[model samples]
Target: MAETLRIALAQINPHVGDIRGNAERIRRARAEAARLGADLLVTPEFSIGGYPPEDLVLKPSFNADAAAAIEALAAETADGGPGVVLGGPWVAEGKRHNGLFVLDGGKIIARRAKHELPNYGVFDEKRVFEPGPAPGPVAFRGFRLGLMICEDWWFPTVSETLAESGAEVLISINGSPFEVGKAQLRIDLAVPRVVETGLGFVFLGQVCGQDELVFEGASFVLNPDRSLAVQMPLFEEAITLTEWTRRDGRLVCTPQKLAPIPSAEEQVYRAMMLGLRDYVNKNRFPGVVLGLSGGIDSAISAAVAADALGPDRVRAVMMPSPYTSRESLEDAAACAELLGIRYETIGIGPAMEAFGAMLAPAFGNRAPDITEENIQSRARGLTLMALSNKFGDMVLTTGNKSEMSVGYATLYGDMCGGYSVLKDIYKTLVFRLCRWRNAHVPAGSLGPAGPVMPERVITKPPSAELKPDQTDQDTLPPYEVLDAILEGLVEGERGVEALVAEGHDRATVLRVWRMLDRAEYKRRQAPPGVKIGPRAFGRDRRYPITNGYTNLIA
Candidate 1:
């Protein structure tokens, strides 16, 4: 008997609703696996319709399309004799199932519905999918294989079931989203599964950025001894084979070390870079452009673009106005210099003044206020849009989740980009990233030593630099306080009373809660960024923008 079992872990990126395209990708991956002489190929969960198709899976015709697509995938495998485990949505007897269609010898020989449908933290699978009764072990080329879906990995029962069912190895499909330390978490979780099941466990996770979520492709296999046998890259797509050995009927997974953790900024930096790269590349864009405010957000965005798509393809435009600070100018200049990007300084001062002059007559009695400040932003937006119009570069917006959740951003001003890069990051995480960059540099990073951001940018009072001496603290609580409350209210699902119980001030907590509730409309209009936390305020944590909601204690 041969000791080696060659299996390809395909970290494929699938676009939603593009069934034909996704099927084609599966076919291509299968062909590549055959070329490499792999015995089996495993793809990510819901690769056919992409992850979290939401209500789309509820459609009967869509599931039919998915079934047809799986037939095509099964037929391809019949020719090369390589078994495949592909994920898609299935409909049977008016119940929808998140199914894994196993194909060998060009036919759907075995199938399994995902047993666990997660209901919390970015998953609403229970609403759409009915639980499967039980699926027997899928036998392929003399091996009894167990199949597990995305959330089933979080539990030991699924693995125990497979072990009890005489499964020799466990192969799981996942659409797991990226977050800090999540790569390590995946491996850590898999260890117990392997040890208890007494079988080699392989994880195949989706890659690429979809809407607000970015899937970090750190696929790996763990031996029955609970040791990491093989590991893949963190943020790039690659299909590689991990060969397992069988000696004296004992399955042995080859030893492989995990990839080193990049700096905090480097981790976030690569995430955005890959997110932008995949979003642009998969969507078929030539390049990207963004407003460079010299602030931490845009500066980091431009730097990411330069690394993802070379400097030649990236354009950074600084749309400055009368209120734009000199420090902003210097920092923007220094950032562009550091990144080696194509920098342009387009003064919006003239346009801003003209717009103010045009509106001065109607605003005679009213003092210049937030409306006037926003006018400056809209003016800069117009200029950037004009430039984007001239050259067909996609504009990337830079706004953190904290500001987006609280209406701290201006529409048609800083919001004038095709995609938002830091939409999931809070202001506190933003500072953490800045410090992370100073400590550890990523591959091809062009930022400076000490800090890519200026000292004033970090330690000085936080401001939008929209108006003179206007600091963020003047209008809102500190980033530390605000982010904590948000995490409790949003992620931890803690109510206002609970927050107060947790030691937050009653008035302050209510004020922050109002800001978050009021800003729902703003978030609805904001561009999507990579989701790094449980509640990203976009597709993950959805609330009605016009609701009159209050959880404040008297």
Candidate 2:
């Protein structure tokens, strides 16, 4: 039996539906692993077709292409280098499955399908993939590897069965998405399995943005004694070779240098940067253009854009209306200068006037209220859209979760954009992220190292600037109160009476709940944004547009 083995954990990013391209990425990683004298290369789940290909895997042509690509990669193993264990969609025994294949010596040596198909929140694997039977360890060169797909490692049955069946090591290939506090949760879940099975664990994951989802690749390894053997950095692609040896008749991994974990704020900021960067680059957008209002939402959004795509690719426009404050104009200019992004001022005064004159004939006796305010917002939206159309830059909307939750934004108005960076961030967290960005430029940031916004921009009361003397508090509750209530309503999914019991005003809680329900239509029309939290809108949290069941208790 071999006394020592070197396994390379490849943390890579794969584009969905790009079979040939993803196969090339795997080949590159395998080449690097061979150079490092590794015996085996383990990649993330669905590395051949990317994670959560949605309905794309259902097509027979795509599956055939993926199968062919996997076979081609397997043939490359004949070069007497490292073998590969990779994930892809497979159809066998008249059923479709999320399969993990072992490629060795120019052919597929073994195949294992995922037993657990995640169905909750952001995953619908059960709908597309049929669960395979409980898996056993796959025999490699003098080693038995307990292979688990992404969701299979979450439960105890698979690991327990593998250990009982004489598996020497546990390896889980994952395409898990990122959410706040998820890294620690991964460790928390992993340690228990190690304790139960008493085997070293290897977790390899992908790092990329797939539409509304962002996968932070913080792949890691746990020793048989439940100690961390290797820690890969988050939000970046890396390949680390872990050496294993038989100690006391069991496999044990040698300790490697651990990468420092970023602060929570930094993690979220990096996730935003990576998410925006991958979305723009992957979707082939030339660049991004967003309204750089002096408000915190737009300011932070612009900062993220500049950091993500570099200053030259990001464009900031100030579309000031009559209600826009002079302070806002100056602050926007200062922020644009700080970030070194392209800035231009296109006044929406003409558009507003034209719309008013055109609608004046139809409304003779009615006085102006929110209707006029909405027109101003729509005018600004129209201005931004025109710029996007002319320059082919994608519009980056700047609405936060608090505003989006209660319908504070207008649908074809302030919400006009191809994507949003702050859609999942609450108003309270928006202020915190701005302050954090001012203090530190994240590691791979392309923007300035210093502060990205003026101090007053963070301190000032937020406003849409649709009317004179308007603040967000004019229509909604204070952000402190509103965000707290929203966390209970949206994240916690608590009832109105439960919030009232927690010392929130009964009337205020009821009002927030009603508004949240009424705004479903608007949210359904909003642009896709980076998902930072567990219950992000769109894919994570799905609610019926027309619902009669209200969780209102007396």
- Off-target runs (Cα >4 Å) in candidate 2 are none
lDDT (10s digit) by residue, model 1, range 420-513: 6788888888777766665555664433333444555555566677788777888889889999998887888788898999899888888888
Please report how far candidate 2 places residue 127 from its true position, in Å.
0.8
- Residues 1-554 of candidate 2 have per-residue lDDT tens digits of 89898999999999999999999999999999999999999999999999989999889999999999999999999988999999999999779999999999999999999999999999999889999988999999999999999999999999999999999999999999999878778988999999999998888889999888999988999999999989999998999999999987668999999998898899899999999999999999999999988889999999999999999999999999888999999999999999999999999899888988999999898999899998888888888898899999999999999999999999899999899989999999999999999999998899999999999999998888888999989899999999999999999998988899999998999999999999999999999999999899998889999999964863
User: What TM-score does prediction 2 earn?
Assistant: 0.99
Off by over 4 Å in 1: 1-4, 55-66, 79-81, 92-95, 126-128, 246-250, 261-264, 438-460, 495-507
lDDT of 1 at 28: 87
Give the Å shift of residue 254 in candidate 2. 0.5
